[model samples]
Target: MKINPPRQAQEWSYSSHQESIGEALSSPGIRSNKKTHINCGSSARMAGNVCANVDQIRRQGRWNNTTINDAYLTNLPRELVRSMAGFPTYCRFFYLARAILNPPTSLCKKLFPAIGE
Candidate 1:
């Protein structure tokens, strides 16, 4: 549960300020209409996905464009979002469902270091 070490081990940054759960999840500088877009801040529990605009979709084709309506944005993959946010491999899966579903698919996709290695 402790992400940071004790003061004897390592000193915390004085400049670093704690953000609220909503602030931690918000996608700043993104201009979005609430009816059409859902930022990570929209739901406290669902930090796994964030609304991506149409321009973002075209720029990044990794997400499924067909699943969402044009009026609304698409959700990015949790793995990707977590990585971008500098989460470690262990910290990426925030909940049980994501922990259960993501690893197998991710492992299958890798070309080297076969399973159980």
Candidate 2:
């Protein structure tokens, strides 16, 4: 399917080099041992939801950090990843998503005062 171009075009920077997915992932600094830590704020933590201590959990290797090595994308489809990466890197789409999640009344209001208003 052909995607409609945005009214304002976005420019994407191209990296000089490209390599296989495996090579790209393991090419140093790309791999990570830290698992994803999503903080749902103090309210959620106090309500006994989500982990409060990411380090503690990771130390035990139970819910520890995850490494973003080549094998990390083993389950994810390559085509999907490529498709997402291929899309124009417009940042407006991201702002729309952020506004939906947190609304402008919070931090976004202050951070993006002119735009949020």
Winner by TM-score: 1
Q: State the lDDT of candidate 1 residue by residue for 1-117, as single tens digits.
A: 123434676764433323222233354543333422243233322322443334464444333445332323335454566666656445434454445555565667585456646
After best superposition, candidate 1 residue 14: deviation in angstroms? 54
Extract clashing residue pairs from model 1: none
Model 1 is weakest, by summed lDDT over 10 consecutive residues, at 14-23
Q: How many pairs of residues collide in model 2?
A: 3
| Clash totals for all candidate models | 0, 3
Cα distance off (Å), candidate 2, residue 62: 53
Q: How many collisions between residues are there in candidate 1?
A: 0
Query: Residue 41 deviation, candidate 1, in Å?
Result: 13
List residue ranges in candidate 1 displaced over 4 A: 1-69, 75-77, 88-117
Taking the tens digit of each residue's C-alpha lDDT, what string does model 2 give over 5-72? 33456632222122232244466546533212222222323322232344443333333235321222
Which candidate gets the maximum lDDT versus the true structure?
1
Error of 2 at 46 (Å): 49
Q: TM-score of every model?
A: 0.19, 0.15
